[model samples]
Target chain A: MRAPIQRYRNILDFALSSLLRRKGRNLALICVYTLVIFVIASLIFFVQALKREARELLIQAPDMVVQRMVAGRHDPIPTIQAEAIRAIRGVEAVQPRLWGYYYDPVFGGNLTVMAASDQELAVDSVWVGRGVARSMRVNEGDLISLRGYGGQPILFAVQKILPEASELVSSDLVLMSEKDVRALFNFPEGLATDLAVTAGNPRELATIAAKIVELFPDTRPIMKTEILRTYEAIFDWRGGLMVVVLGSAILAFIIFAWDKATGLSAEERKEIGILKSIGWESSDVLLLKFWEGAVVSLTAFLSGVLLAYVHVFFFSASLFEHALKGWSVLFPRYRLVPALDAYQLTVLFFLTVLPYTAATLVPIWRAATVDPDAAMRS
Target chain B: MASSPMRKSTLCLSLIGVQAALFLVMLLHANAQKDRAIHQRLSSGILVRRLGLTDLCLFTEARYTRHPAMADRHAAFQDHPMGLDHFPSGSLLAPPTFPSPHARTHPAVPEHP
Candidate 1:
């Protein structure tokens, strides 16, 4: 065992020297290989992190959101529907949600106005999101006025600015009292945007959602699971689209690796022959070449993954952030919580490291098996 | 031959060291971002009540409300029909007492406000 270990160490040393001998070519190969891995790893990390963030935040969301559809368009749900939903079996609570979009001409953007139940606001006061506060140049206690449905400017004191930390969800959010929202949007007295339904038993969520549709044919019950699946599909589709876009480059790299592996340079062939002639067994020659491939690939893999982590988590995935985050005028700048999937890393390793290492083996074997004098002459 | 192996091993070790250093830098950056997020959450007011930091929340709110610019704006908007009249004079930071239209009618429905 000690002899074998010592022999492998010598092979590794020789492999390193051999690689250093062709510094320019190997360096170029390592650079390109590392770049390819970096792009793929960054995409995977960005998508997974966004997905994890969505899942974490959505866990606290209501089990089912019941909305009324009129002529295939979302319509305000009547408050009376809440009573019926409340009486349904397995339904824990049914709360009517008041929320709407307010188009601000000044900024040429829409602000999401929602009723806040936790903290009360005076009739003339409202809470603005961090983005809104910044864009409007308004701070706490400042009076910001908005044009209501009646064309009258409704003045509201800025009671508090929603935290910038929650900006991902609240960037364009405005929390106002129900009366303020109703007055601003001119929403009718007994109508709500939708109903947030909670289930007493987690298992009964599906049953309650189905019953909701049955009870109200025109109503749609959107379950949290469906929303999660929708988000997953969206990210997967975008990630797939990017992969397709980078497919040609990836193919080029693979071809380059294949060509290099099969057509070992004359210098490398002579080196192998010299080793074989000097009492080095074919196995030892093969192991030396294997180490060369393994060292280059493993180093590239580690460096690529590290660079990708910094790119996605630290730099906010600049190249793909805009596309994945969707379009908004006042987009919230928030650091995504870094989340890694071991399965994804494993798949990446197999996809990149395995094929390149395997490609080297065939040419190494061909060179190792030949007669030393014939190989050297060639 | 001895020197060649020694030099090669040193080179390989240096390469690995560079990668490890980059990884450490990323870890530190991630930690910084996490700390920033925590600070933002603390100051954002949303978590104040939940975290039992209402005193800090109120103090911050009071400071903002008492600023000269805010006081001036409050006084200027007094003449507007839907303005400072709705706010009780001394209770500028008071919680709303007016029930929303839905809460006014359907008392059974859970009110979020």
Candidate 2:
């Protein structure tokens, strides 16, 4: 056991020295490999982090939302219907929700206006999101006006700006009192934008929804799980699209690696010849080659993944943020929580490092088995 | 600068070992950080639910984007079913499985009768 261990150690030393001798070539290969890994790893981390954040936030959402349709368009739901929905056996309670959008002419962006049932704001006062605060150039005590649905302007005082921690979901939000919301939108007294439905047991949500639709044929009941599933699908699509776009780069790297593996340089062949002449066995030659490939592949993989982590969690993956994250004017600039999926890392290993390592062995085997005199003469 | 093969091999092996250890440390640090963030974020997320915020405001550009859950699926089809979507974000979403009301194919009264 000691004799074999000593033999392999000597082979690894030869591998290391040979690698250092051709530093320029090996360095170039590592650089290309690192870049490819960096781009792919960065994409995976960003997409996963976004999915996590969305999932976490969705836990707060209502189990079901019912929307009223008029002539195939969304219309203000009659608040009177909440009692009818509550009459459904499975539904615990149905809360009439009032929310709408306001397009800001000054900032050329849209603001989400919502009314909270437990709001503490005084009449004619509103709380704004950090994005709204930054874009509209307003802070607490500032007054902003919007044209009502009746073509008249309504002025509202900024009560408070929401905290930075909630910015991811609240960036374009404006929270107002129920009375203020109805007034600003010139909303009808007996109507709400939609109905928020909660069920006693989540498993019964589907049954509760079908009953609601039976009661009101013109309404659509959207489950919270449906929305969450849609978000998951959208992010995965976006990430998959990025990977497809990067497919060409990955292919080029593979081709470069294949070329390097199949065609050993003339000097390398001579060096192998010299090793065999110096009483090195064929297995020793193969061991040296394996070590050489392992060193380059492991070094590149580690550097790339490390850089990707910092790029995503620390710097917010500014490199590809615009593509993966949806486009918006008041886009929230938030750092992603550091997270790593071991399964994804393993998949990345199979895609990148394994192929190159395997490719090196076959071509090196052929060279190792050749007679030393013939290998040197060539 | 000729070092013993044993020393050279030891140095090379140690270099790879250090990188491997660093990579493991990074993964553990990420997991620890994630746990910390989850606790902090759960508190903030409660505010979102309390306010009845449905859709995440990923893009504040259009009404359809700001609250896609309540979006009017037929908005593009206002003119006709095959009308093209004008919003960029609209195209990214899969055709929503909106429980849109459909005309009854089996009539309450038989057409033949």
Candidate 3:
């Protein structure tokens, strides 16, 4: 074992020296490989961060959601449901919510608005995202009049403005008082658009959800954890796309590797012949090739990771808006708050980098199996 | 033992053909997947409409308005001058007309079937 390790070390040293001598070609290969990996990694980072950002915003916002369904339309649930939801076993609090657009017939487009059922409870207050506040040009205590459904003029006094939470999903919320919500549109009592529920044990969430459904068959219980499930589905779809891209990258790398290893130049053939003539085994040649592949692939992966960080956190993941944002009219231009913990890095390394590097071994193994004299003659 | 460049060219062409075939397969799969996605979206939209799920966001109601003049006119038209021989050409409820091309020259009479 010691002898093999020492021999491998010698091979690696030789490979490193050879690469150093041919810096221009080696560097070009490294750059191309790095770029391909970099784009893939950046996409991954942006996608994960986007999901996290949305979930984080949602986490603080609701535990369970209740929306009214009448004739398949989501009408505001009567305020009475808020009282009934408070009696559920795991529920800690129930907040009735209202959301609508305030159109100014004089102005062309609608202004987004949201409100709560009770002002003092702060249950349905304007959750002003950073972007909405900036765009609406209004502050807390400013009275804004908006045209409701069918041109009914509704006015809301901004009681509070929500501080910016997550740029992913928080940039679009507006909260208001229940009285203001009713006065705005004159929707009757016992009606709410949705009820936000907070349960005690996060583990018993499913049981609690079942209970709620049993109690109110008409309401849809939107659990907060369901976002994670949705993201998993989304990620699975993305993973399929990545499999194709990464698979192609690996195939190309393999072809290049096989061509380089099998079709040796005259100088290389002469050198190998001389080495074999001087008692170097075929295994030694294989080791050298393996080391070369390792060096190139590792260098590419490391550089790609670093470049992905810059692309996501520093440049704000600009290359990935279409997939992550879908067709949202307003997208917040914000840098990803990357969670660069050891676990994430370890996962990424194993998941993306290792698969590509391992693909190089098939060609290396083929080259290694060749008879030295036959290889040299070829 | 030098292999002819033509032989090498043929090998390269074969590899290219293999890669092209693989890529074509991937493209077709992707397109099929995309078509499925569009189909799903359309079906989901229809489901939402059928279920009235979209009604939450976009329900609008239309109510009929009661106007006394229109009601009176309709009632009078339906009654058909039963006790009287001729229909009144002018009524107090009719808006005063200045000289106009649209005004009736005489009272309208009901035609017997």
Give the candidate number with the greatest DockQ: 2
lDDT of 3 by residue, B1-113 (tens): 97645332244335445644653453354345445434433433432222112111100110000111001112322211111111244233452343221123312322211
Residues A1-378, candidate 1: write the lDDT tens digits. 899777777778788888888889889889999999999999998888767655555455567778798876568999899999999999988888887666565653457677877656667788887778877778998988788887677888999997667665566667788888898998999999888888899789988988888889999887767656655665676687779879999999889877876688888888888888999999888788788888888888888999889888778888776555433345566666677777998899998888888889888898899999988999
Tens-place lDDT digits, model 2, residues A268-296:
88888888999888888888888888888
Candidate 3 C-alpha lDDT tens digits along A329-372: 33444545563444655676675446545554555556446666
Docking category for candidate 2? acceptable
Off by over 4 Å in 3: A1-28, A50-61, A88-92, A101-112, A116-127, A134-147, A151-166, A179-189, A200-212, A235-270, A278-283, A341-344, A347-373, B1-113
> Which regions in candidate 1 have their CA more than 4 angstroms from the true location?
A1-10, A150-152, B1-6, B17-113
Superposed on the true interface residues, model 2 gives a C-alpha RMSD in angstroms of 13.1
TM-score of chain B of 3: 0.28
**TM-score of every model versus the real structure:** 0.77, 0.86, 0.60
Better of 2 and 3 by DockQ: 2
Q: Which scores higher on DockQ, 1 or 3?
A: 1
- Tell me, by lDDT, which candidate is best: 2
Instruction: Output the better candidate (1/2) by lDDT.
Output: 2
lDDT of 3 at A317: 67
